[model samples]
Target: MTSTLVVIGHGMVGHRLADRLRELDTAHRWRVCVLGEEPEPAYDRVRLSAYLRNRSRAALSLVRPDFLADPRITVRSASPAVSVDRRARTVHTAGGEPITYDALVLATGSRPFVPPVPGRHLGNCFVQRTVEDIDALSAAARPGRPAVVIGGGLLGLEAAQGLQLLGMRPHLVESAPHLMPAQLDGEAARVLQDGAARLGLHLHCGTTVVSVDGGAGGLVRSVTLGDGSVVEADLVVFAAGIRPRDDLPVTPALPLAERGGYLTDAFCRTADDRIWAVGECAAVLGRCHGLVAPGYRMADSVACGLTGHHADPLDEMDDSTELKLLGVHVATFGSTSGDAGTAVEVTFQEGASRYAKVFLHRASGALLGGILAGETGSRADLAPWVGRRPTADLESVLFPAPPFRPLSP
Candidate 1:
């Protein structure tokens, strides 16, 4: 007896879920149907900025070349899931096609949050989310022209770098006091600011975009800041943030998070057992994980549940991350900052480029959270030790033994 499964959105996390179910369901107990909004199949979204340099579609693809040919799976590109009728166990597509399913998974992912500025919808303004968005931006940007990227976070900085590669002078604007507020603390962000400057991006932190000014041709010409400063821009790219794509199938009965997203339990199951959500569209424990790491974990858990295994409730997730942004290395493990009574901080800096900070419980000597900027040579060794107890000596815990440890009691 084969059960039909309908997966909405074919992004990386959605594809991972589909692949996992197929691999584990050896008895052919499940048949899968995937509906993707984008014309292209799943690709490496983390490497999206890199597409500006290479301009090759195949380079960013996440699908195995021959995997989609499986008879048990059916994929439809450019077909988005418009609605899900839980009562009838059917999904409606944008093309007016109805897909029946025994189980449904929502992987609608998210869309870039473009601020409602006056001229945002004008020409030469783009949001960095899909391949088409980047392509349109590339075509609109000209060499040596001034470009404004409205965000100093990871994606915004990446977009600025991509604009630079296209021979455009880039300016980065951030509403927060510093860049990467979610990942790096104030000090770490200062060092990262210096690194971004070295990469040829002019930065403006602690400012808000009041409005975008357009030229007579209905194209963006400049942006006005809160302090009455106007920056001339030939092209503007918005990488401010993301909002979950939750408005579909008009299901008001489904549980939703505070902001937006399908509220799911530990196993990524919604109030309706037959309906499950994963990826950016899933809000678990009242928190929506925007990053891919947690999404992958959720997909793994869902697969385990569907395959007749008792999926253990997730106790914790390794949200620790280490990645290079705009020629700077940034890593955050466990916690980025500590404010508890037992919090104790230790910091280590080398030369002018590398910085590391660690927080631990003063009484138990257990690791709390940390931030690392510049050269992160020890991140590989440090991140794994998070949440564990260290020796009586705190200095050794802050800095690990030379790359490969000597290992002593």
Candidate 2:
């Protein structure tokens, strides 16, 4: 009476689905099979930079030792699914093994987007994605040397920070006018830029890398900027963005979203009901959410659908994010952009290190979205009031009074 569920790509979100399924399937109604392309089991990629500090792989592992020991759950590491036979409901692996499944899920996740610039394929160029990538970067890092980090977003800043931790001077380059343009407003970005400068990070904003020049042995030497300037570099790390890995080979090609990723319904189901997708691989309603929270929600939805429970639609997936880069706290929730000019804005600032801005509905006082930079102590408290009006006064909500402290004797 039991059915088989095969999941491809044993990343964080993929493993969550298997774990959730086992938790809900108390009757042992389903057996799970996880296919991972990496030789090691799932690890915390979000904390990948931590590996640079401790040099411990086990510390980043997301899987518990005993979790995979269950007889109902089978894990095959270093086994990448090469193709899927939709008609036969079979997944073929690179090792020439075929897995049959009653229900199949794609959690292939995403790949780091590398921009096409000359010498990008040089030996010193790397992408910040996996532990192995970090290891490679650590091996190549030399103290006091200059390193160029492409992109100035969350991941790029993290990579730059990691390199700085490794004793390299990091020069961050971004095509955008300011850092973290996607997550921060202009004022917030300015605050972050000042903070970054204080941390000894050289930033190149509003410019693109025209080309990367390499020295002997095909190793990167320097990068040419669009403004006819060049920055010397011993290494370059790309953290521009990500694209979903939805191009997996299938007998009949699966439809893809316009922005890339397997097209899926709100329930994370593909055109074929038996096949589903979760995580970055699933493009629900023609949009792909790059954050892990939304991907976890998608995984839960698919698990519920497979278990005969009412699956929640992807409409409620929260894309809010909180981050700390080089000792600076930044948080963004809901719609931070008021470009359409339909919302009323509230702003507050204190010195060079603190800034907060919230957008409200023009007619209703309901929260539209907001950005917090420098001080994010209220992030957890403010997140829940994202779409709804706050019970407390707007001033108190935006700037909660500091916790009382006893005076020194």
Q: Top model by TM-score, which number?
A: 2
- Candidate 1 per-residue C-alpha lDDT over 7-76 given as tens digits, one digit per residue, 9 for 90 to 100: 9999999999999888889888999999999998899888888898899999999888666988889999
Tens digits of per-residue lDDT, candidate 2, 1-409, equal 9899999999999998988888788789999999999999888899988889998989988888677888889999999999999999899999998999999999999999999999999998999899889989999999999999999998899999999999999999999999988888788898889889999999999999999999999999999999898999999999999999998997788899999999998889888888898999889988898989998899888888777778768876678888777778888888877754678777777667677788877776788888888764457767788678866565565556643221111
In each prediction, how many residue pairs overlap at the backbone (N, C-alpha, C within less than 3 A)? 2, 0
Specify the highest-lDDT model's number: 2
**Model 2 misplacement above 4 A:** 339-341, 401-409
User: Model 2 Cα displacement at 195 (Å)?
Assistant: 1.0
Itemize residue pairs with steric clashes in candidate 2. none
TM-score of each: 0.94, 0.96
